[model samples]
Target chain A: MAMIVDALSWVFLLTGGFLGVSGGIGILRFPDFFTRLHAAGVTDTLCAALILLGLMMQAGWGLVAVKLAFIILFLSFTGPVAAHALARAALHGGLMPLLHRAEDDPSKS
Target chain B: MRHIISLTLILAGFWLLLSGHFVPLLLGLGAVSILLVVAIALRMDAFDHENQPLHLTFRFTPYWVWLAGEIVKSNIEVVRCIWGPVSAISPTRIHLTATQRSDVGKVIYANSITLTPGTVAMRLEGDQIEVHALTRAAAASLQGGEMGRRVRELER
Candidate 1:
């Protein structure tokens, strides 16, 4: 059971690290500022969640695990709020996202 | 009244969890601090249903689980778009009608949309939310109304 927990923790940590790096690549690869928010969102939400969950698993059932859970809870709450604020600020600052209109795609009616 | 009680209990639990020291002196200090915080909150008129939201506790667990799954799914999609091709992402802005009755529910709906990668709820005015999706597929998924419906359920 201990070994299994350790294995699961490593899997989570590694996947989270990979996703975090993917988010970085996304920020560079995505065309515009608004699009980059999505990439950063990936790191804030799932990547953070995975890393914290992995740490919680390694900590096992204790106050340490409880504190980690609280961190996850707070991160999920604040991450999106911060993202929304950034997106809104950019929009209000007259930075228009390069949008793909439904008319632009001939395939969609 | 109920909100105050719930807030007190939550703060107490939070204090205990953070401190982890059961010594009488520390516990007494924790109690004093929690009471002080709660009193300040009450004075500030912050002990309301909207802020405390004790009613949502039972229902929130299931909603949170569902949201975590949605986040993971969208994360994978966004990651793919990152690695696959720049042309793969459409970057569309769409308007969504928030069907939730209360401010809390509407906020939850908007945040859940933003929480899922590949989409960000940019502007929320009254019953309408302006969202930017990384791809047309993400826009289509938000148009599905399933997540919005689930958030509405929490209000009831």
Candidate 2:
């Protein structure tokens, strides 16, 4: 049982580390600010979640695990709110996303 | 009245769990601090249906689990796009209909959209939300309405 838990923890940790690096690469590679937000969202959401879940497994069933759960809860709430506000502000400031088709305008009636 | 009690209990539990000091002085200090915070909340009129949201508790857990699955799935897709050619990303802007009836439900839907890695809810106006998706297919998946349907179910 201990071996299984250790293996799972490592799996989650490694996958999270890989995703975090990819998200960083994505931010650099993406064309515009809006698309880059999607990359950063990857790091904040699933990457953060997996890393924390791995830590929780290491912590076992205790108050430390509970605190980790709270961190995940707060991140899930704040991550999107921060992303939404940034995206909203970017749009309001006239930063247009580079679309597959330029004619497909979101602001047009 | 109910919200105030719920808030107080939650605050007390949080303080106890965080502090971990079982001494009498700490307990008294915690109680006093909780009372002061609750009093401030009352003065600010923060105890309301929207703030407490006790009605959605039972239903929300399942929705959250489903959303976690969605996040993982999209994280994989976005990661693949990241590692692939830049042209692999479509970066499309689309509008989705917020099928929820209440403000809280709509906010949840929009936030859920934004929470997923490949999509961001850029603008929310009445029943519509403007979304910027990493790919056109991502936008199409959202239009399928499974998530929006789940959010709608939360309100009931």
Candidate 3:
């Protein structure tokens, strides 16, 4: 059981690390303001979730796990909502849309 | 009502974890501390989130872990940008479109933008973010779509 838990932890840690890097890269290298928003949100939500989950497993059955779970839940709900608000603000303030590359524009109109 | 209890439990649990010992005195102290904090919270009227339960947190832990790495990476980038030769620096202003609708999300996005290397969220005027980046690469990073998409996913 301990080995299983340990393995699970490693998986979670590695995946979290990978996503964080991907998100950082995505935010750093993507093609527009809106695009960057997507990257940041992904990193905030998904990357955070994976990392906490690993901590929960290592914590085992206890308040530690519960607290970790609480954090994850809070992030999941709050992360996107915060992102949404930020994005909307950016759009309304007349930030540049990827005129040539926005797949969302045609869909919105 | 429920939120109060929930908050108490959370506080107690946290207190215990931090204390890491279970003598009668410690346990009594933990309970008292939890009560005091919860009382203060009540006085502050932090009731809305008191009822918040742990929900779907496990689902995104991995992503958060990865975010830590990004923070670290960005830290390096920021240091290099600020400390490198002045000739390597290029001050720029860029506007990125926003696609979110919640205040919390907006703050997080803004903070994250500032947290990353080479960028500062100078203004969040409506939908456009007036950002200042130390370099073109930093400016371009603001243009990326991944952050926007990820934030949207979290909203869902």
Candidate of highest DockQ: 2
- The sequence of per-residue lDDT tens digits that candidate 1 reaches over residues B1-156 is 888898999889999999999999999999999989988988888545456666688789999989989999999999999999789999888889999998989999999999999999998989999999999999999999999999998997
Weakest ten-residue segment in model 1 chain B by summed lDDT: B46-55
Q: What tens digits encode model 3's per-residue C-alpha lDDT throughout B11-76?
A: 776677656688999898888888888789887776454323333233446645555566556545
lDDT of 3 at A64: 77
Across A1-109, the per-residue lDDT of candidate 1 in tens digits comes to: 9999999999999999999999999999988999999999999989998999999999999999999999998998999999999998888888888887655422111
Q: What is the C-alpha lDDT of each candidate?
A: 0.91, 0.91, 0.62
How do the candidates rank by DockQ, highest first?
Answer: 2, 1, 3
DockQ of each: 0.65, 0.84, 0.06
Return the TM-score for chain B, candidate 2: 0.90
> Which runs in model 2 stand beyond 4 Å of their true positions?
A106-109, B46-51
The sequence of per-residue lDDT tens digits that candidate 3 reaches over residues A12-104 is: 888788777766766666556654654565567556877898998888887778778778866755665565566556755866545332332
Candidate number with the higher DockQ (1 or 2): 2
Off by over 4 Å in 1: A102-109, B46-51
Q: Is the docking of candidate 1 incorrect, acceptable, medium or high quality?
A: medium
The clash numbers for all candidates, in the given order, read 0, 0, 67
